[model samples]
Target: MKVYIETYGCALNKGDSYIMMTLLKESGHEIVENYSQADAIILNTCAVRLETEERMKQRIKELRKIGKKLVIAGCLVSSEPALVMNLAPESSLVGAQSVDKIVEAVESPTRRIFLEDSKELITPRVFEGKISIIPIADGCAGDCNFCITKLARKKLRSYPPRSIVNAVKEAITNGAVEIELTAQDTAAYGLDINYSLPELIKDVLEIEGNYMIRIGMMTPELAMKEIDDIIEIMKDRRVYKFLHLPVQSGDDRVLKLMNRKYTVDEYKQLIKEIRNKIPLVNITTDIIIGHPGEDEEAFNNTLGLIKELKFERIHLAMYSIRPNTKSALMPQVPDPVKKERMRIANKVYEDVAYSVHSEYIGSNSLVITTEYGKKGSIIGRTINYIPVIVKDYNKLGDWINVKITEASFFDLRGQLIQ
Candidate 1:
């Protein structure tokens, strides 16, 4: 059988698609490049936000017109399986938890099936031939009022430190330059078994991987608990110096309403401590504007903090109320208000992004070459996770020194220092 996979949502989703492809191949199936040529079409859907879900719906509708024997498998199928069935009646449904069962779905004649529970099968996957993204854990216990994903994901369960180490070992052996450790919350890793992120990293680093490990996004609440320990552990040569902490809001009232345990002030203190100790560390965060009950003052407070922090990257998303989440029932934020607030957040981010990026104009950075840019430019990212576009491939994939000649808010243009 030939199968085609379409992935949406975060890096995790992409990782799942890769795993599915690899598993299918191992299970006597061929993975096709195009849906038109495949025996089946599988959409690894994402429902992170209302807009993303709508886009998935739109894609499903369009694909159903031409894509035959469709399979809807991802967070969307997990969270709203019935809705997916309603839309694509003939489609098979699978959830994020059911990622390992993609081959069965493709071969079976089932109309709708759910296989989303418990994770830890040692599924090591590499995405886009560039990096390895391994799921060291899955599910998040954090019950943020605005999150629907939390509901869909089962529980926080971290794989044994040795398991992750083995996966990274295999990935490195496969010529992966990067090993990305991901989950709903990397900070919550091992809490179920009384282990911690630091312990996990130490184990993985000992696996003798030439590739670098990029720790996925972590909440400040969990990360701040053992900041010292985390810093010490992450200093390993294999670990990248990038930390992504999501701060949904910068206002206490809004934070409380959103069920976020930490106040804006507490999050800021964590940020300050981390940056104070690790100067030049790349700090990135997620900001969700228009979360229920977010007022103008709250929004501005967020804006103020963004200005102060000057994040290397800001993943700003307009609040999208998911069904069954606590915030969705609270006074509905007007769509127009959400749009305006998103604009404000984006604008603030734009200015800081370009301005902060400009400082590297004359500095040299170690970039992992990913793609070639137009007109003699090759693109990669710094150890700090900032995108740098180099004019030539002194080499791609291998780390190379780039002296920044010009910088933009979103990317940097550099010349090969060699």
Candidate 2:
């Protein structure tokens, strides 16, 4: 069978798709590069926000018109199985936890829905390009008021250290130059299994490899609990000097309303500590513009915080009311108001981000080519994870020195120093 797999959402979802593709290939199915050529299409989806969920639904509708068999996987299966069945009644439904049964779902004439808790890990993945995404854990320990992901991915279930270590070793052995350790909350890993993220990193680093490991997003509260150990592990040269900790809001009141456990002050202090120890680290965060109870003052507070922190990257999004979440029951922010606040927040973020990136306009650094960019250009990342685009053709996974010639709000343009 010729299969086409499309993935959405976080790195974890992408990793799951990789595993599914590897499994399908091992089962004697050919993986097709084009959706039109596939005998069946598998959409690995996301439902973190209402917008994403709707987008995924629309995409399924689009794919259904092609007359090919469809398979639905990922969070959407657990979050809105009924709606999925309504949209594509003939499609096979394989939930996020049941990815191992993808072959059965595709081959079986009857519909298959696998929503049971799956503890299996260490699945083989087809590494693409120079990067390989490895999921260290699934789900998370948080119960944020507005999060539908908590319902989709329940509880913290960390993969065994031995399994994760073997996966990492396999990736590096297969010429993977960048390994991304992803989860819903990477710092909360091992809470259910008595393992720590630092310990996992130590085990991965012990493998003989010339690659760098990039840590995924972790909530500020959980990150704070393991700060000392995390910082120590980050000092290793094998790890990227980058941190992604979403602050969400800058006002304590808004944070409390969002059910965030940590205060804005605590978030700031964590950033301070990381910068003090790893002075050249790049810090990125997420900010929601109009969450419930975020009045003008709260919005302004978020703007103020972004200006002060000067985040290397800001994932600014408007609050989306998701079904079955606590925040949906509160007095919702007006859509117009959310749009206005989002505009102002976006301007603030661009200004602050451009200012931070401006400092790299004339620096020289060693970057590993990761992906292709626009107009035949190539994209690479510095040690701090700042994206650099060069026009010269370079082999993937090769380290090359480049001089920063220009800067954008989010990335840099570089010329290879020949």
Candidate 3:
């Protein structure tokens, strides 16, 4: 069978897709580069926002039109099975819990494989791929009020530490230059099993990988408990200095309303802790505008925090109510208000991001590669996940010095100082 698997959403899904790919190839299936040349089309879906869901729907429709065996996976199909089925009746759907069985589906995808978990639960941190994503945990353990993933991914399943370490080594062996350790909450990685995130990271760092490791998003609650120790492990050159912590709201009251379990002070402490340990670390975050109860005061508090933090990057999104979340039933903020807040937050992020890059106006940065740009300018990211453009391919997978020639609000234009 020739299988074409297309993935969407976050890094976690990317990891799942790779593992599934490995399994498919092992099962003697041909991995096709084009969907039109395949017997089946597996679309790894994302449903973080309305726009993302709409995009998946459109892509699924397009694939079905080509009349291939379509399998829809990821957060979107997992969360709303009936809705997805109605949209594409011929499609087979699998939830996040059953993601591991995607390989079996591919082997015999004429039948739907509702694979959420393996009875074995043997997740490896190292797999065979240069661009690899390995799961540290599954679902999440937090109880945020407005999150739909909580319902979609209902358990706190932590992978065995030994298995994870082995996977990391395998990926490095396969030429993986960027090893991403991802899950619903990577910082809460081993809490359910009495181990901790620091312990898991310790084992992973022991693996001999020439590439860098990326730690995924963590809530303030989990970060507070392990940040100090995590900071110590992150000092290793293999660990990237970027921290992605999502502060849904900056207002203390809104935090309470959202059941985030952390107040403004707690979130600030976590931020301060990371900054104190890793100087000039790329601190990025998530901000939701116009939640059901967010007022002007709450919005203002978030804006102020963004200004103060000057996050290397901010993922700004308008609050979109989901079917099962607690906030959906509360008094809803108007759509116009959400849009206005998102606009303002994006503005603050752009302004601060530009100012932050100015300090590097004359410094050298190490980067990878971006898909776009003309011959003279190629793009890549710094160790901390800061976007940079360097005009050289000799250093494509290897890190090289990029002398800053100019700085833009979103990226830096530079030349290889070598």
Taking all chains together, each candidate's TM-score versus the true structure is 0.95, 0.98, 0.93
lDDT of 1 at 162: 74
Q: Which candidate is the best by TM-score?
A: 2
TM-score of 3: 0.93
C-alpha root-mean-square deviation, each candidate: 1.7, 1.1, 2.2
Pairs in clash, predicted candidate 1: 354-409
Give the per-residue lDDT digits (tens) of candidate 2, residues 116-206.
Answer: 7664664556778889898888889988998888888876778888888888888888899899999999999999988889888988889
Residue lDDT tens for model 3, 1-418: 8899898988777777776676677667777889988998889888877788889889988998998788888888877777788888877777777766776666563657484655655453334324577888888989888888887778888988888888878777777777778998988888778898888888887777467888888887888887889899889888888888999888998988899888888888788888888996888888889987789998999999988878878888888887678988999999987887788888888899889988888887777653345665556768777777665653346666788878766878778775
Which stretch of 10 consecutive residues in model 2 shows the poorest summed lDDT?
116-125
Best by lDDT: 2
TM-score: the better of candidates 1 and 3: 1
What tens digits encode model 1's per-residue C-alpha lDDT throughout 45-109? Answer: 88888889999999999889985788888888888887888899987777888777777788887
Against the reference, the lDDT scores of all candidates come to 0.82, 0.89, 0.79
